[model samples]
Target: ASQQFKENLTLVATHEKKLELKRSACPKPGPGQALVHVRATGVCGSDVHFWQHAGLGPWKITDCTALGHESGGEVVAVGEGVTNVSVGDRVAIEPGVPCGKATCNFCLTGQYNLCPTVDFYSVPPKDGTLTRYHVHPAGWLHKVPKSMKWAEIALLEPLSVCLSATLRAELKLGQPVLITGAGPIGVVQLLCAKASGCSPIVITDLSSERLDFAKKLVPSVNTYQVDTKKDAKTAAREIVDVFTNAADMGVQVMPEVTMECTGVESSIHTAAYATQSAGLVFIVGVGKDFIQVPFMELSVRQITVSHLFRYSNTWPRAIRLVAGGVIDLLPIVTKTFPLEQADEAVRHSADRTKFSVKTLIVDGEE
Candidate 1:
C-alpha cells in the first residue's frame, strides 16, 4: 500500500451551494473496508439542500465536504477481514454506516437507520461518495449483478427509501393510497405502491409537469394538479372528491394510507383530510423545524402520523425487486454526466426552469 496511490478527483460543496472539484489524496482500505472505484452517484434533493445551506439541521459544513449518498461502484481493493466483497465486485453503496456496537438497541432490533451515532454520507462534514475513489465499510456495500447499469444500481438507495416507507405505511394489495408531491421520491413511491398491488394509486403535485411525468412513468397512477393558490381545506375537498368519496354521504371512501412527500404545511393538512379515519400518514419529506399540523382533526380521527429518517435492511429487498424485474427505474433517470461534469449535472438537476427527474454522475472509462 503506497501512500502515493493516486489523487482522487472529489466534488466538494461549500457555502451558498458552490461546488468545486479538487484533488484529494486517496487512502488505502483499512480493516473491514473496501476502496471503491465509484462508478455512478445520483444527485438528491438533500444534496442540493446541503449545498445551499453549507449543511443541514445542526450539522454545519465548516470545513466543507463531498455530498452524495446514492452511489454504485466497483471494488478495486479490500482490506483485512473483508469477506463478503472482493476486488472487482460491482455493488451499491449504503451510505449510512452505523456504529455497529452491540450495546445499541436500534441495531440489535434491525433498525440501524435509527442508530444515534450513524455516520451518513453527505450529511455535512462527512466525505461522501461523490468522488472517483471512496473507502466504505465492506458490510455497507451490497453486491449487484454486472448486468445492472451503473445509474440503475445507484438508484437502489432511493428505492430502498421508498420501499421502507411503503412497508412502514402498510401499503398492500388492492388498497387505495394517496401520495403528495410528484418529485423523484413520489414517483418512486408510485412504483413501489403499484408493484405492491395498491389499487387506484393517486399522486398530487403543484406542478402539472411533475404530475404528468409521474403518470407517464406509471400509467396506472392517477394524477392531480394541485392548486397552490387554494387554501388547504379547499384543496382537501377537491382531492377527496377526485380520489374517493361515494355518491352516498354515509358511504364516503378514502385512502387507507397517505404518503406525504412534500413537507409543505398545506400539503400535510390536505393529507390529513384525504385519509380515512384510523389511517396512517407517513412523511418522508424534510420540512421546516416546526410546521402547523391539524392535530385536533387527526386526534379526533385517531389517524397516526410517522416519519422516515432513512432506511435499514432495505437494500437487499430493493435489489431483489429491481433485479428480479418487479420494477424498472431507468425511466426515472432523466440524464447522466461523466464524473468530470458533476458540477454541471447537479446544477441541471436542481434547476426548476429545467425539468429533470433524476440526474446521475458516472465515472467514465479512463
Candidate 2:
C-alpha cells in the first residue's frame, strides 16, 4: 500500500490564461510532510477568479500555478517526523500553513490566519492541490471519518470558514442574525448559525435562484431578494422591517449579528445599515481594494465591523460536524468532473447560468 508515484497529471493555470494537464514528477514528502493521493478538489470562486485574472490582490502569477485549495485526499507516504497521518489514511487537507515562528505575534497567539508569512494554497504563486497528488504538511492533514465521501470531505474547507466566522461572532442561542449573500458560503453559514441555535435568521441575495437554494437548505430562513435598483438605505430599511415586525418575527428588533458573505459594496452597506445598534458585523467575504463605508453611522451606532482572514483551529470541529451528523454537505456538491476536465470544472464554477453551488474535480468517479 506504500507504492510511490512515478508521475501524475497536474492541472496547471498559466499566466497567459491557459489551463492544461502537465506531466509532473510526483513529489515526495519531506520531514513533517505527507504525500497525499488527492481524491477530489472543490472549485472555489477564488480559483475561477485566479484562472481568469492570473492574479489576486498583491499576489500575481509569474509562472504556471495549479489552482485548487479545497481538497481531501488519502495519505500515500509519510516523511520523517510525520505521525499525524499514516499510509492510506483518508484526510482533508487544510490548505494554508503559516510560518511556525515564535517571534511572529499572530502565529504565536494562534491567529495564524493573520500571519504575515502565511502560504495560502491556490492564491497565486503557490501551487494548489488540483492535481492527483500533492505534498502537504502532516499537521495540516485532518483525518476525516471513513463514512465521509471524498468530495464531501473537500467541503470541510468551506464549512470550516463558515464555522470559524460563526464562532467569531460568538452566536448566542436564539439570537437573530443576518447573512448577506446566498452563495456557497452563505448557505453554509446558515447551517452553522442553525447549529448555534440562531432564530429567525435572515439572508439577502440579489438572485432569487440562489436564495431559493438557500431556502431549500434552511426552510426557516427568511430569504430576502435584494432589488439592486434600490439604494442601500432603502433595502436596509426593508430588512430592518423583516426583523422588527414583532407580529411576524420573534421578539427581535433587528438582527443582533450580520455576517456579510457577498463582499459587494452595496451589500456591505446594507449589512451596516440594517444591523441593530451595538451589534456585530462579521465580514466573511473579501471585497474590493477600497470600499466606501458609512463611517459616521457605524461610529454612532457603535457597531463593530470585523474582517475574517481564513480560519484558525477549525479543521477538527469541521470534521466532527459532518462525521457526527451535525451537518450534511453532499447537497452542496451539485456537479462533479473527473480530474482531466478540471478546466471545465473551473469554467463550470464561474458560469452563473450553471448556478451550481459547488463543483468538484475528482481523481475519477468515486
Give the top-scoring candidate (lDDT): 2
In candidate 1, list every pair of residues with a backbone clash. none
Model 1: per-residue Cα lDDT at residue 175: 84
TM-score of each: 0.95, 0.96
Q: What digit string (tens of lDDT, one per residue) describes model 1 on residues 158-257?
A: 9989999999988999888889999999999999999999877789998988998998998878788888788877887777776664222455557889
In model 1, where do residues sit more than 4 Å from their true spots? 1-7, 15-17, 245-251
Model 2, position 339, has a per-residue lDDT of 88
Q: How does each model score on lDDT? A: 0.88, 0.88
lDDT of 2: 0.88
**Off by more than 4 A, model 2:** 1-6, 245-252
